[model samples]
Target: MEDVLELYEQPYDPQQPVVCFDERPCQLIGDVRTPLPIKLGSARRVDYEYERHGMGNVFGYFDGLAQFCGRN
Candidate 1:
């Protein structure tokens, strides 16, 4: 929307700071098999299959004016 875009376009001000916050539900996953170690010029190889261990909540906070971020 125009209102959201206009808010983002405003210059950063320390006193009147702009902050954004978001959260996500993350699925904890694990490999079915032990991954192959990395070799020269090659990266570690993972299996095509995975196992779901549990769920987790991820939160993010950002201050546009101070260019600061925090995560949990």
Candidate 2:
């Protein structure tokens, strides 16, 4: 794990930018019921219920150099 963590310390190299990637399985969900419309003086309200559509994979990547100097 230390070896992986150390990759973050690498200096930014425009010619060879260090990159990190990860993927997470996520649930796709939506409101089971339509939200109640908001009125003049009331806050819009949504139902607490949700419906799962299916499973999804989310992928993300980061440029080590982009955050080397806290630029990102």
Candidate 3:
């Protein structure tokens, strides 16, 4: 839309900060077995099995001009 584009074209103002916010549901997972430690020539190995502990939300806020961010 023209209005949206115009908003983006405006110069940044610290006094009137513009913040963008977003959130999403995240799955909390954990490995079922202990992973093997890495050796001199070998890499660590982890099992494919995982347990879902619970669900949670991840939030993010950002201001492009001010280079500020907040998360939870």
Candidate 4:
């Protein structure tokens, strides 16, 4: 990134917006079913399990000049 920025510095303004474009896929998982109810004397609990499915692709556009752009 520094090399590219240096090369472009001659033509592109440092203060100008130099944006970066990228995309990524995110995955989500969840349990199949909730746990069964327990008897009066026994303990009862509800739990869920999750499995990963194909995630969707996300697109991002970023500029170097922006102060508050990307935050993870």
Candidate 5:
């Protein structure tokens, strides 16, 4: 909405800092076994096998006042 966008246009206010939050559901996966380490003349390798651990959530936070946001 226009109101949300307007918040970012205003000058930073430490007293009334604006913060946003979001989260994404994720499936957690893990390796079944230890990976093979690389040797002097050999290439490192990983097994094709994997195991599902459980469900999780990835969260994100943004600070409009500090102009600080992080994501890939």
Candidate 6:
């Protein structure tokens, strides 16, 4: 990250363009119904099976001179 910043500052042109690349991973969760209620005193209940929806990876690009406010 520091290397990227240093490279951008070397040429130093306010009119020129610079962009940063970053990514984030997001997890999807599903709620399952329990067979026993907590008040019944029968050891908590949880489902052994689950369905996987999908995972997401978000890629974001930011304009260095634009207050870090650019997305694609």
Per-residue alpha-carbon lDDT of model 5 for 6-37, expressed as tens digits?
88788776778788889999999999999988
Those runs of model 6 whose alpha carbons end farther than 4 Å from true positions after fitting are: 1-3, 11-15, 34-51, 68-72
Taken over the whole model, the C-alpha lDDT of each candidate is 0.81, 0.83, 0.78, 0.65, 0.82, 0.67
Tell me the deviation in Å of residue 34 in model 5.
Answer: 2.4
The CA lDDT at 16 in model 5 is 80
TM-score of each: 0.54, 0.66, 0.67, 0.43, 0.67, 0.49
Q: Positional deviation of 49 in candidate 4, in angstroms?
A: 3.9
- Give the poorly placed runs of model 3, Cα more than 4 Å off: 68-72
Query: What tens digits encode model 6's per-residue C-alpha lDDT throughout 1-72?
Result: 898768666653446657668999987766566466666646777787666678989999866655543322
In the range 13-53, model 4's lDDT, one tens digit per residue, is 54666777799888866666776878888887766566776
**Which is the leading candidate under lDDT?**
2
Candidate 6: the clashing residue pairs are: none
**Candidates sorted on lDDT, descending:** 2, 5, 1, 3, 6, 4
- Which runs in model 1 stand beyond 4 Å of their true positions? 36-46, 68-72
Candidate 4: which stretches are off by over 4 Å? 7-16, 35-48, 68-72
**Each candidate: how many clashes?**
0, 0, 0, 4, 0, 0
lDDT of 3 by residue, 1-72 (tens): 898667656777767767767999999999999999898988889999999999999999877556633321
Residue 3 CA displacement from its true place in model 4, Å: 3.9
Candidate 2 at residue 45, lDDT?
Answer: 96
Query: Residue 59: error of model 5 in Å?
Result: 1.9
